[model samples]
Target: MFASGASRRCFLLIVFLLCAIMSRSGVQGGANLCSVDFEVFGNVQGVCFRMYTEDQAKKLGVSGWVKNTRQGTVVGQVQGPTDKVREMKVWLSKVGSPSSRIDRAVFSNERDIPKLEMRGFGTRY
Candidate 1:
């Protein structure tokens, strides 16, 4: 129908305007990308902490790298959607490897990244 063409055009225009508004409002389609660096202290080394962290990060669809520090702690950086990053931080702080005793997790250098700096989660060294 001729009316159908006009209505379709109007709908597309509306959709375009909505997308513009959303982008201008700081929406990145899915969510804002966030990155954070964390160091977990207390009984983290030699406990498969980095392995567990890698698994959890992959499961949460995040990308980052984890490693053991010379000071017997676990250090890592996580980058993903804001909510996913928050969840990862909680897991690092509270629900670390079953064999690991997490005294506390210190997060630093947290910022909103326009894009992810890493691809895929893994253990470093």
Candidate 2:
């Protein structure tokens, strides 16, 4: 009976150790994921541009947040598969907010983006 109890305790300890290892590994794996940031310029403000960008991004399965900057530029940081990000850029450039005109767009790789819970999109003061 004592031997059985010892064996059970040892098994539980091993399981606990494995769980810890997996959790740690998962965090490291997530850190390795890549993301990108985009700075969109031109009539990107005051015409529901941010909202439109968010919608397009969501439709493309791109994960990120979009907000208006003080300079009237729409800034967005999208993180996901490279292809999806590119698709979002194309969609935004071609068929974004009808009232807004896009002047320039810059893309760059970023470290990681914090998860955001946005309804549609929003303007930042």
Candidate 3:
């Protein structure tokens, strides 16, 4: 309902300011950067869990590293847009691989990071 020229100008200014603020907060429109450390337990090893994780992460546009722990667990970090990271979490908790059973998924140290640390998803070793 901006009828006058001055009113339209004011509306545009407000829109611009809002965009600038959102960009500065690691949020570009609806996207935001996030990071989380995760540990997966249960029959995760010997089933190509890391490979499946890398595949899923790349599909979802999340970047990080996954590696098999000495304690028979899988540990890794995931960093990406908030929505993509959440999707990755869901995948980790439910669908690990066709042959593996996920008993527990421990997520911790989750927070909004400044930026992504990895370029693409890959297995560390």
Candidate 4:
């Protein structure tokens, strides 16, 4: 039977909280997938940066592709579990190949994805 208004509101509130928790914990379908595009500045090119990026992505269990841009920068897109994607971002922004110098990193098109766009990490050139 339908309860009083207060009781009904409480039940709805509990359901809402449960849904929020599930989504946050990635219990819901595809809630934990994230996608981001990044460009690394500084001496990123000709330093095996793309190779290192692919390696890092694979290590982190993410799927993406990295390539050298004509502007003397490294560009890529990464998609995977939210936490792993975050780690990859940090690696691109701060740490790169042994000989690479990272002056700045720019990220764009960041969004939550329903699924990964790629199967495995790879170099695009």
Candidate 5:
């Protein structure tokens, strides 16, 4: 009886752990729960800012894309470890476009784009 009880407890624990892992990855849970969105404003256009951002994101292993808006802003989506996303924001502000000025940056947990493929953070049409 003692051995059977121990085995049951172990099985329950394993099941709980699996659920937790799956939830964190947004696989079992709803999508956009683990991703981050960023809106970068400034002299982000016309200075190769998009290319620079793409390079940085790829180096940091961030999965997302950067693009320019008609209103002259740079918008990007980065999905990865939360820490890495935060670090990318810092890098963008400090090492972004030399000719461009990063006037504002906004971070949100809401997932707007769905399953967007990002290849090295380049510009999108």
Candidate 6:
């Protein structure tokens, strides 16, 4: 029993040290970091879509930039935890601002990233 207790304590200590190291290195606790670029089509422009996207991304702890495309679409790249990025994608596809109509959400250029490229969500001109 004493040996088991000692082994468990050692394991916990190792995990704690690894967590501290990852934190100092600016990495989430075993969470994958990734980026995805998406474009929303149909009635997305001039409807506060970008603002809403920024808000959602910030709420989800996603770091990236969003912009309005001249082609009447909203385009953006989001980088963060895989789960949070997926959540953001769902939000963009289904619940985009109260005023905007999201017809189609197409995602592309998604890949694992070493780190976040942006600090917070922002609307790009």
* Candidate 4 segments exceeding 4 Å error: 1-28
Model 6 CA deviation exceeding 4 Å by range:
1-30
Candidate 2 weakest lDDT stretch, 10 residues: 114-123
**Model 2 over residues 19-79: C-alpha lDDT tens digits?**
7887666443332334667788888788988777777776776677888888878777776
- Of candidate 6, the 10-residue stretch with the lowest lDDT total is 23-32
Compose the digit string of candidate 1's lDDT tens values, residues 1-125. 43798898998999999888887665756558999999999999888888899999999999999998788888989999888999999999999998999999999999999888889998888
Model 2 residue 100 CA deviation in Å: 0.9
Assess each prediction's global lDDT (C-alpha) against the native: 0.91, 0.69, 0.92, 0.90, 0.74, 0.90
Better of 2 and 3 by TM-score: 3
Task: State how far residue 45 of model 6 sits from its true place (Å).
Answer: 1.1
TM-score of each: 0.80, 0.59, 0.80, 0.77, 0.63, 0.79
- At residue 13, what lDDT does model 2 achieve? 96
Q: Write the per-residue lDDT of candidate 4 for residues 1-125, one digit (tens) a residue.
A: 55699998988999999999998887888478989999999999888888888888889989989999899998889998889889998999989999999999999999998777779989987
Error of 3 at 87 (Å): 0.6
Off by over 4 Å in 5: 1-33, 110-120
For model 5, how does the per-residue alpha-carbon lDDT over 19-101 read when each residue is reduced to its tens digit? 88887776663444236777888888899988888888888877887888999988877875556677887877667877888
RMSD of 4: 3.8
Q: Please report the TM-score between candidate 1 and the true structure.
A: 0.80
RMSD of 1: 4.2
| Top model number, lDDT | 3
What TM value does model 4 have?
A: 0.77
Give me the runs in candidate 3 sitting further than 4 Å from their true place. Answer: 1-7, 10-30
Writing each residue's lDDT as its tens digit, candidate 6 over 40-89 gives 99898888999899989989989999999889999999999888999999
Cα shift from native, residue 96, model 3 (Å): 0.5
Q: Model 1, residue 97: displacement in angstroms?
A: 0.4
